[model samples]
Every structure is written in C-alpha cells, then in structure tokens.
Target chain A: MKTLFDKIWEKHVVESITNGPDVLYIDRQLIHEVTSPQAFAGLRKRGISVFRPQQVTATPDHNTPTLNQHLPIKEEASRKAVEALRENCAANNIMLFDLNTEYNGVVHIVGPELGLTQPGMTIVCGDSHTATHGAFGSIAFGIGTSEVEMALATQCLLQSKPKQMRITIDGNLGKGVTAKDVILYIIAQLTANGGTGYFVEYAGSAFRSMTMEERMTMCNMSIEMGARGGLIAPDETTFAYVKNRKFAPQGEEWSKKLLEWKLLFTDSNASFDKEYSFKAEDVKPFITYGTNPGMGIAIDGNIPVNEPNVKALEYMNFAAGEKLLGKPVDYVFIGSCTNGRIEDFRAAASIIKGRKKAENIFAYIVPGSKSVEKQAREEGLIEIFESAGFVFRQPGCSACLAMNEDKVPAGKYCVSTSNRNFEGRQGVGARTLLASPLTAAAAAVTGKITDPRELI
Target chain B: MQKLTILTSPCVPLNVESVDTDQIIPARFLKTTNREGFGKNLFRDWRYDSEDQPKSDFVLNSAKYSGQILVAGKNFGCGSSREHAAWAIADYGFRAVISPLFADIFKGNALNNGVLPIQVSENFVQTLFAEIEKNPKTEVTIDLPAQKITINSINLSEYFDINDYKKTCFINGYDDIDYLLSIKEKIEHYEVQKS
Candidate 1:
C-alpha cells in the first residue's frame, strides 16, 4: 500500500542518488519573470537551450502592471525583467503567455485553467504559490533559480522525497466558511512549522465536497504553513474541471487519462508519516492577527494572549487578547492566486451585491487570469463590484505582492484575501489582515472588521 | 556554486522568530536579472529606515557583532520561495545559518548557493543564543565532515544532519546541474519507455 504522494513521486523518479535527492523528471515547469531571469541567464551562460522546450511555460506576472497591458512598463527594472523573459522564452522556444495574451496571468492560475496542470504530474515553478496546482493531484512545489536552470537544461530536478502527512476533516463546514477559512483554521491549529518537512494530503468529506477552484485555494496556501505542497485525490470533480480545457487530453487520450487519474488515490491501508483530524464544523471565517498565517483566529475570536508573537503583534499595532472585531480597515483587496477564481468573486459578490462600499475603505478586485477577467465581465461580477464602488483591475498578481504599483500605503490596514501576511509583504509598513473574500467584502462595506456571516 | 566547508566565526544573533524571506529581502528589490550585489539590500527594510538611514538598533548595524554565521530563532526562512533570500544571505557574507528549524525551500536554496543551513535542536539553539548574548565574542564552528556544530565558549557540541550527497557536493563544489546533466539520457529513456 502506498500513499498518494508516494505513488506520484515514485512514478516520476528517474534515478535516486544514494542517500541523496532523487532525479525527478518534471512533467511541467512554469516560469515567471521575477525568478526565471537568472535561470535563463545561467542557461545562456552555459550555451544551452531549454532541453525540453515544449514542456515549459513562461509568464510575466510578478511585476506586470494590472491597469495597462499594451503600454510599456514604467518601472525600469520591471520592464527589464519582463523583456528578459520574452527574449529568453523566444530564443529557447519555450511557450510564453506574454503580457496582453489571453493566458497572461499569475503563473499558478494560468496553468490549471489552460489544462497544463494535470493529475499524476510533477510540476515545478520558481514561485511559492506553485503549490496551487497540487489541487489537481500533481506534485508541484517552488524551486530556486539553480533548480529552475536544472529543469530548463534537463527537464528534471533533483528533489528529496518529503515525508507524507494526511490531514482529515470529516464533518460538513458551517455557513460562511470557505476553503480559505478551512486552511487558515488548519494552519492555526498546526502552527506554521508543523508541516515543515512533509507533503500534506487533504482528505475526508470536507475536502471531497469542495470544487476545483476552492481546492486550488486550499492548496495555494500550503506553502504558507511550511508544507512543500498540499494535494487532494482526483475524483469526478477533477475530471470534469479538466475535461475540455486547451491542453487536456482529448477523445481516446481523455479516456486513458481518466482511467489513470481514477487510480491516483491513496490505498485504504496506506499509512502516512503523520496524521491529524479536525471537524469541519470547527472552522469559521478566519483572519490572521499576526504577521504569519499560523497566527489566525476565528472571525469572532480573540487574539491569543500566550503565544510567542509579541513582535508580530507590535508590527500589526495589535495587543494580545484584544478582540479584532470593529478594527478599522483602510483597504480591502479581494484577489490573489489563492482566491482569484470565478467562485471566489461569486462569493465576494454574493455579499456585496446590494450594498455600497464604505466611503472610508479603498477596495480592489483583481482577476487571476485574462480568461477569468473576461468571465467576470461576462458574468457581471465586474459590474456588480463597480456599482458597489470597488475598483476592478485587470488580470495579474496585483496588490497581493508589492512588486507593481498597487501597494497598500504605509501604516494602512488592509483586509486582503492573499496568502502570507508577513510584515511589509503588501508594502513597506503596510499592515495586512489575511481573510476570505467574503470577509474582505464585509470589511469593504463596513470599513471595519465585521464577520461576513453578519452581512449575510 | 562555492564549496562550503568548515569555518569558525563569531555569531550574529538576530533573536527574531519566524523571520520570513520578505523581511530578509523585500519584494521590491527582486527585479534584477543577475544574481550579484544583493548583499547591500539584505534585510533592506530592517537595516534601513524609510529615508535610507541605517537603523542603529538593527543587528547588522551594531558594531558589537560581526560574523559569517547568522544564528537566529526557530523556523527561519518560513515564507515565500524566492531564492533571493538565499542569494542575499550568501551575498551578505553569511556562509551558514543556524536555527532550530528551517523551511524546506529556503534550506534547499541556501544549500544550492553555498550557504549552509544548520538545523539544531530547540534547547541547543536557546543555549547558543544565551551564550552568545552573554558574550558577543562567543565563537561557533561547523565541521562538515564530522557533521557537528560546537559552541566554543561552552565547549558543547551536537551533531547536525546533512545527506551524504549534499555533503559531498559541499566538499567538492559540485553543481546539481552537472549531476542532472550526467543522467539526462537515463531520464529521456525513462520518458520514452513510459510514453
């Protein structure tokens, strides 16, 4: 009997170095402008082209401005990075979804929607959120520039097999709870470093009931909790989500892939290195008070008074044991690779449909991809958000990171739906309260930390 | 990559827990194409204020501390997989980082870039911090072949873990790309057989 991760990992192992990392053949390598430049430079210096160009995909997301697609980047270094990616991808024959392309978006979001991410595949990217693709039952994790260069030159990465951990949530989730809340709750319970050396497999009724997009949100934050990646077993939901996408298998190949994917589950008697169980009913719309994701609390809960988080609390201008309710929110950004899918916007719109954004709050909604942006436009999400006074931006990883111009001003508090609430992550001296889009919408409406359930 | 071997030096104790990569080097400074000259901006926000003045309170700015090893709190390098953090550490002249725990990606990045990440027990880390704070001149040594980290002031040491292959690479300055390229045919053969 083998765990789901062991099966996928073993299938991809070309050779194992004695007492060392295995040479793992990567099925897909997603590259972005920020981290791929040095790797491309390394390839150029070595006088080698990408070994398996067809298996690689490149995108310029980290530094691209959300508002302008056609105009040249205003920031000099950012323009240079995007241009470097273009030159490298073009010269190496690697496919690039450049700026303004239909697929140009966050690297993690573009892969799944385009069907480049598949079950039983080994994927690597230079961005930590590369873990987002594990929702499709793939072995995806972030790598450094050297490893990126190795993948480019050999289509393989030398990786050690991470220990397996199975986290089970048996009961049904309560109202107002989303995948973001579930993962946040899990991180709170397990602490940030609990998953440090393991790859987690999310199991049980709670995870099974989630849609592909929601599952992606769950896996996207796996890196936040120190896990290499998190994955769920592929089922009919996974198959349907991947069925007719651009790069998914077709006809006989689809049938063959379906059969292969059906066998991607862990055996009944398979044992994990560690196991933990939580009731789904225990989850609520959660939010982080400290700088780390693991310092989260339930929507109506108080900040823990006893944790070793004095520094994080000071950075956020919060006191231990203080209630976060009614905390003023100066900004509300409801998008990221974590929760930037159609369902996430639907959740946010469900709460913001008939209400006006608070005059004191500046709100933004950035779609994950060009297709997602177009679908939001078609489905009236953009109109609904605009009508409520929320500024809807074009696709890219906007505001979630401080790379581009959409930075949260210094000293302002933002209720963001992005991962990682580290100090100065959104901007220098910017305080981030990580939460779900519904909660962010509630904050946008009230200009304060209000539980989304109250608005509902 | 430079070959990482044994060295003894005084420690720079950050004393902060869960120091994320964003704090190590902010995202705004990551746009460069080359991997050189990141040392100046390492801990950019912490080392300098809004007006680019060095914060005298920061550890790196204090004249009392100078070392090639960064002995920090637990769970160091816990967020974001930017290899830039490792690059910054290596660029800032830290040959090794000793912490009670390390995040996965940062550990790999450090190893790849010739910066050693030494994972010690929680109690040992606490003792090391206490001993170093008591005397800033306290020296520490990491012996690669023996896999032992010692606090010279206390004359106490504990064995650390590093896989044989990585140790071999550290000793010989071997590149992972070279190893992977050596087996490219095996991988292509495996792909063909599977397809």
Candidate 2:
C-alpha cells in the first residue's frame, strides 16, 4: 500500500484486538558479547530455550581486542564477557561469531556483510546502533535485555508502532562531502530529538546517488536524531551490494530475488506523517559543540557563544561566540560501527596522506571489521596511517563507548567520529566532539580543530 | 535474602518533554556494568555543574516537589539502549515513569528493573503537566496489582501486557532464573520421561 516498511509492519503485527499492544514478529535477533550475557542468563533462569535459534545470531565484538585475535583478552572483565557469550551460545544452541572466526566483527558490520541481514526483515539487537540494518529497507531497532529474553522465548515483541517521517535530500553533494556529512548536517538542522516518534525514510536524488555502503553509513546513524531507524529504497546499488554477500540469494535465485527487492520503494502517491527536505549543497562536514549530536555545526562555523541560557553554555564549555578553528584537541578516535568501514578510512587517509600528527594530540584509528582492516591493509592504507603517527588498531568497537582500556582522560577534549558526544561517552571526564572521519583525521594531524575541506 | 519490594509513593509529576536517556543517565557513566551508585549520577551532567554543585535549572534540583513516581511528557527515554539509564531511574527512587510515549528499549529496561513505564494519552499527559505546574505537590497513585494509575482524582485504567511468564515472575518477585529453579522438579520429570 504505502511502502515495504508499512507492509511488513502491518503484516507482522500479530493483532491489536480492541485496545492492546501489537505483538510484532521479530524476523531476526542479533546479539553481541557486551549486552547478551544478562539476556542469556534471563533465559536460563526461566528454563526457556531460544524459541527460534535459527533466527538469532551472536558475535563477540565490543570487548574483543583488535590488536591480535590470538592474544587472549588482557582485561579480565572483557575476557569474562567474551567467554560468557561463547558459553551462553553453546548452551542455548545459538550461532556465535567469536573472534578469530571469519564472521567476527562489529555485529552491525558482520550482519549485513554476511547477507544475514536482508530486505523487509525486522531485526532486533541489544545494541542501539542496530538501526544499521535498516540500510536494506528493513524496520530495525534495538531492544533491551528483557526484550531480548522475550524475543528469545517467543520470537515476538510487543511494540507500539512509531509514526513515519520522510526526509528528502535533493541535489548533488559537492566534492569531498560524504554520507557521514549528510547525516551530520541533518542532525544539525534537526535537534537530537527532532525525529523522536518517527521512522524516517531517506529519499530523493541525493540518497539515490549514494552507494549501498554510503546508504548504510547514513542509516546507521538514524538513532542519533532519535529516529526509530532510517531506510533507503532498494535500487541497483542495493542489489549489487547483496549479490555476492555470504548470505544473499545465489545463482538463478539471485535474479528473481532482485526483482522482488525492486518493489521495496514507496509508490508515487505514498503519504508520510511528516516530511522535510534539504539541499545537498547546504550540507557540510560537521562537529558537535554541545553534549548531543544535534548540537553540531559546520567545521568552519563558530561555537555559539551568544545563547541567553547558561545551561547551554555550561554544557558545551563555550564562551559567547568562538570559532572552532584551531581549538586545541587532546585526542582523536576514528572508529565505530558508524564510520569504521573502508570508505571512511579512505576518506580520512586521503586527507592525512602527507600530514604529520599534531605535537600534543594522541590519535587512534580502529577499523569496524576484520574484512575492512584487511582491505585497508591490502591497499597500504595502514602504512600511510602509521607513517602519519596514527595508531592502527584491530577491528572492534574501540573508544566509541570506552568499554575497555581505551578511554580519554578526564577533562581532555577529544574529536571522535563515533556517535554520541554525551558528557563522558569516551571516558569519565573526557569531553567529546563528534565529527565525521575526515574531520577527526584533520583534527588529529593539526593538533587542533580544523575544517576537513581546508586539508583537502 | 529478603524479597525486593519497591513501595512506590503517589506519582510525582515531572512534566518535561522528550526526556532522553542522556538526561536519565548521562553517557559518561555507562562505562561500568555494575548497576550500583548510578542513582547519584543520574542526570548528573544536567542536574549539576562542573564544580559538583547542583544546577538550578534542572527539575530534580527544584525544592518544590520530590517523590518516587515521575510523570513526564511525550517521548521519555529517547536515546541509547543503556540499561544503566533505567537502573539510574529506579535507583534514584522513581517507581514509575508515566509519559505519552516511551522509547522501546528504555521501556524494556524499566520493566526488567521493576520500574513501571505507563503510556497514557496526550490529553492526560497535558493535564498532568498542567496540574503539576499549578501545584508541585500534586500526587498520583499507581497500583500495579490492579494495573491502574490514578492522577488528579481521575482514574485511568490500563493494562500493561507483559509476557505471561514475565508477569508471573514479576508479581512473585522472581527473576527468570528463580522461576526456572522453582520448576526444577517438573523439568527433571520431563527429562526422566525423555530418557
């Protein structure tokens, strides 16, 4: 009727009988080491087996060190969490992608690359960035431990459907701009909570121009603005990306599946609850000034100093008005499910090819997946990074949320590509400025905040 | 060990819109998995200044009202899937969070931690907000057994449909594991039959 999102949501809703919550069938349940322990424990304590083991997939990513897959985890708590996942998966008859396995990496990265994440599937995970799966035109969102248990026991979730919003970005992106910048710009235009009750569909000329990888990066960040998730209609770019993935349809079946996926878009007369549009040219590489993603501004813009409110000023540590340029930085972290892909690396490395690290800055470059790491290394991107004094770490969620030893010291200012600059997301007392990969790299090399376009 | 009983007082109105997870528990405190002491840091950044002093702007810092149940505006707990946010809310002494809407993940975490998340109509939410504005001491009652919430002398009867199994465990103060342990005899019988 409207789009696949509407169709799938309507079809899977078990019932709404009179006045009640709708029980929605979850088509896929992805788990990772960091959040699944308590969920698995809940299941065992209830004496319940996973209702649909085939629908659930587990991986060890967050706490797994990227440096060496063979080296045992150094942190005791991290090691314990990883081991617990292995043991839990074994006991529950669930599939696990432990470190050193071909399937190991960020759950978001692994799910799509393996073809395990497909179009029109409702995917749930214990991690918020689960919106990454929506790139394939699916309705995906994160669930908590109890919900994970509920999904495990029944393969269904009691959900109240979210409102729908379509954000259309038209025109062509200027040279040097990427999908990361587009989403950052959108967040800047709409405050962090702008899309609170809506599932956003990204459409128009700009979105259609994006490659599947680019679309994935854009959709991966839908949660930043409080959207339930983001999606792009399937096109040739989507078909091509899934064609050879590990789990996608094969041989003669692939062509037939492609034909069906082509129908995933909204009809010309489809309606959305709300609509907004922006020009691609207005988008620029952005960085956060306040504690949230919506508080970002273009790299070239001044930190707002003239706000009448004291809370805004105090939260951002900003004076009345100060240019962000040349502001000293203490750390630069470039990795997360959000921007850890090869394209992100290439965009960053291209800007830092001949650059030297700032005298006072500490920089770390962590890839999102082993596959991305291998690809970057094969292209000699590792050498370029090492030569620039950037630490090339293994594939895992590194300083994104500071789960392990990777943390910024208290009160230090950091420029990161990872989402959420909330107070101490990187570490207790560490002030974070969220930006795109290129912007983070530029800041790392300069030892100060600099616009990525200047480096280019 | 004694059973964990959360005796909630009449619901105290919060009346703020889009209360995100960051506002519940700032992202800085999410590093640890241990669900202890988060109540102090709950809304730490929003509730306090850099000098560890309380911010005058935050509602929690206000001297006008204080109680266990929180009545908030639309879209409460809108960011991050951090259980710490829920733990912080519960530990901070909030027994129920009433809003027009709640983020799916945040709602799940609240239920698991024994903090009830009540979804009400927008008109009711507005009425609650107005009442609280008129009198900060306004109170509402939430009777979990009856699955009903009463505010401003208006009774809003609603059913929170949890998993049938989870509902039993919660009412009995048993977690999933405790429920399973209690059924060990039956499970053992079934195992014997299979063997």
Candidate 3:
C-alpha cells in the first residue's frame, strides 16, 4: 500500500542519482515577476531556451498595483521587472497572462481557477505559496530562483524526496472556524520548524469536508509551518471543482482524467513517516499575536505567559497573558493567495452586510484574481463591501506583502487575512495580526480584535 | 559558483529567533531585476533608521562584529521562498550561515547560491553564541571535505552534516543547472516514455 505522496512522487522521479537528489519531472510550472526575471536572464545568458515552454505560465503579481490595472506600472523598478517577464515569456514562447487579462490575478489562484493545477501532477513555482495548489492532490512545492532556472531549462528539479507527514483532523468545525483557523491552530501546535524536511498530507473528515477553495487556503500556509508543501487526497469535491474550468479536460478526455484522479487517495494501511491527529472541535477562530504564524492562539484565548519569544512579543507590542479581544486595530486586510477567493469574500460579506466599517478602521477587501473579482461582483459582494464603507480593490498580492501602495503604516495594527505576521511584512515597522476573512471582517466592523463567533 | 572547502573566519551573531526572509531583505527592495546590489539593503529595516542612516546598535553597523560567517538563531529564513534572502546574505559577503534550524526552502536557496547553510545541534549553537559573546574575535573553521566545524579559540569541534552530492558540488564549484543540462538526453528520454 502506497501513500498518496509516494504514488505521485514515484511517477515524477525521472532519474535518481545514487546518494543524491532525484531529477523529478515537472508537469506544470508557474512563474511570477519576483523570482522568474533572474531565472530568465540566466537562460538568456546561457543561450538556452525553455525546454517545455507550453507547460509554463507567467504573470506579474507581487509588484503589480491592485488599482488601475489599465495604466502603466508607476514604479520604474517594478515596471522593468514585469517588462522583463513579458519579454522573457515572449522570447520563450510561454503563455502570458499579463496584468488586466481576464486570467490574471495571483499566480497561485490563477493556476487552480484555470484548472492548470490537476491531481497527480507535479507543480513547482518560484513563489513559496505554490503549496496552495496542493489542494488538488498534486505534489506542488516552492523553489528558489536557481531551481526555477533549472526547471525552465530542463522541465525538472534536482530534489531529495522529503519525509512524509499526515496531519489528520476529524469532526465538524464549529461556527466562525475556517480552514485558516484550523491551519493556524495546527501550525501553533507543530511550531514553525516542526514540519521541516517533510511534505504533509492533510487527511481525515475535517479536511475531507473542506471545499476546494478552503483546502487551497489550508495548504497555502504549509510553508508557514515549515513544511515543504501540503496536500489532501482528491475526492468528489476535487472532481466537481475541476469539471468545467478553462483548462480542464472536456468531453471524453474528462472521464479518462477523472478515473486517474479518483485513484489519488492513500491506500489502506499506508504509513507516513510522521502522523498527528487533531480534533476540529479544538480549532477555534484563531489569530496570530506574534511575528510567526506558528505563534497563534484562538480568539478570546490568552497569550502564554511562559512563552519566551520576547522579540516577537516586542515587535507585536503584545504582552503575556493579555487577551486579544477588543484590542485596537487600525486596518483590516482580506486578501492574498490564502483567503482571496470568492467564498472568502462571501464569508466576509456575510458578517459585513449593512454594517458600516468602524471609523478607525481602513478596511480593504481585495480579490485574489480577476476571475474572483468578477465572481464577487456577480455575487454583489463588492456592493456589500462598498456600502459598508470597506474599500474594494482589484486583485493582486496586495497588502499581504505590501509590495504596492496598500500598506499599513508603522506602529499600526492590521487584522490581516493573509499568511505571515513577520515584522515589516505588511510594510516597514507595520504590526500584523493574521486571522480569517471573517475575523478580519469582524475587526473591520469593530475596529478591534473581536471574536467572529459573536457576529456569526 | 566559487569553490568552497576549508574556510576560516570570524562569525557575526544575530541573536534573534524566527528571522524571516522579510527581515533579511524587505519586499520593497525586491523589485530590481539585478541581484548584485542587495547587500546594501541586507536587513534594511534593522540596519537602518527611517531617515536612511545606519542604526548604531545593529550588529552589521558595529565595528565589533565583522565576519564572512553569520551565526543566527533557530528557524532562520522561515517565510517567503524568495531567493533574494539568500542573495542578500551572499551579497553582504556572508559565505556561510550556521543555525540550529533552517526553513527548508531557504536552506535549498542558500545551498544553490553557494551560501553554506550549516545545521547543528541546539546546544552547539548555544555554545557557539556563548563563545562569541565572550570573545568577538572567536574564529570558526568550516572544513567541508571533512564535514566538520571547529572553534579555533575554544578548541571545541563538531562534525556537521552535508549531503554528499552538495559537498561534492561545493568542493568542485558545480551547480544544479550544470548537472541538469548534462543529462538533457535522459530528461528527454523520460518525457518520451511517460507520454
């Protein structure tokens, strides 16, 4: 009996070097502005071309401004970086989803929504959150620029197979608890370094019940807990989600692909190198109080007095044993690869409908992709947000890493729905508290950290 | 890649935990296509003030600490798989980083970029910090061929671990792309068989 990870991994292992890393074949490659420029330049320097250009897709997300997609990128450096990507893609004959294109959004979001990320495939992107695509039962992981170039040149990566870990969460989640909370709680329990050198497969009833989008959010933060990547076994939820997307198989090809995907589950009695089980009941709507995602506690829970992460505490301006409930917040961000999907917007709209944003809160509701933005508008989540005094912005990796104009000023507290609360992540000296979109919505309405269950 | 084997140098100690990539090189500096100038902004937030002046208290700014090696706290390079973090460290003239734990992607990036990421025991890390605290001039020697690191002043030595292939690459100054391109025929063969 082979585990799901082993099955996919073995298929992708092209040639294994004795006592060395395996040359793993990649079925799909996703590239973005931040990491691909250097890689493309390396190719140009070598007088080489991409080995399999058709399998690769390129977009500019990290530095793209969320507002004014029709206008030229204002920052010269960012403009050059993006222009370099476009130039490289054109030269390499790779597909380009330029900014303002219907398919353009966050690279990770755009991949799955377009059905380019399929089960049993090996996907690698330069960006770490490439794990977000693991929701579809693929062996997807992030790579550095060097590996990016290697993949671009050979359509393979020289990688050592990581140990396998299965994190099982059972039982139904209570109100206000989201996939983001479950992941945050799991990371808190495991610590950021606990999953180092391992690829995790999330199993059991709770993960089985999460929607494809929710599962995307769950696997998206695997890097935060130090896992190389994370995935879940594909089921009907997976098949239904992949049915009619732009890139998904059509007609007779669909049945053949479905048969292959249906077999993408872990066999009975297949053992993982490590295993941990958590109850969904224990996972509450959580928020991080420190610099790392692993330093999270449930809303209404007290910060640990004995926790010795003094630097994190000082950076967040938080004290031991202090409750985060009702703590003042200056901004609320509800977007990123983690929570920038349509359901996230719907969830935020559920709590924010007819409620004006707090006077002290500058709430920004940005979609993850152009498709998600269109869907939100179709569902009138934008109207709900705009009416509630929350600014609705276009899609990009905005405020999450704050590469663009959407920044939280220094010494300001923002309840963000994106991953990572590291200092200067939102902006230089900006304090970030990571939470779910619902929790971010609650903070936007109350202008403080409040339990979303109260509104639910 | 520069050939690295036996190297001796004093180390810079960053006594901070969970030092994410954002801290190593903030996102604002990541827009540039060129990777050479990142050293100037390495740890930009911590090394400089809002007015763009160097912070006197930061380790890099202090004359007491100057080294090609950076000894950092646990879970170094935790967030964002941006190779720019490895670029900034290498650009700042740090040839090696010693830590108790390293985020996986960062370790890979560091190794690929010719920045030696040496993972040692927690106790060993603590001892090194203590030794450095007592004497800023403490010298650490990384003997890559022997898979060992020695603290010359304290006479304490420990055998570190590196993948045999990576050790070979370091000594020979080879990169993944070179190996991959050499096996271009094999890759093409595998693709044909799979299809």
- The best candidate by lDDT is 3
Ranking by DockQ: 1, 3, 2
Q: iRMSD per model?
A: 0.7, 5.9, 0.7
List TM-score (chain A only) for every prediction: 0.99, 0.96, 0.99
> How many pairs of residues in model 1 come into backbone collision?
0
RMSD per model, one decimal: 0.8, 5.8, 0.9
- What is model 1's DockQ versus the real complex? 0.92
lDDT value, residue B37 of candidate 1: 86
Candidate number of the best DockQ: 1
Worst 10 residues of 1 chain A by lDDT: A304-313
Please estimate how well model 3 matches the true structure, expressed as its whole-model Cα lDDT.
0.93
TM-score of each: 0.99, 0.85, 0.99
What is the DockQ for all candidates, taken in turn?
Answer: 0.92, 0.21, 0.88
Clash totals for all models, in order? 0, 6, 0
Candidate 2 per-residue C-alpha lDDT over A393-436 given as tens digits, one digit per residue, 9 for 90 to 100: 88788788777668888778899988878766777667889888
lDDT of 1 at B30: 95
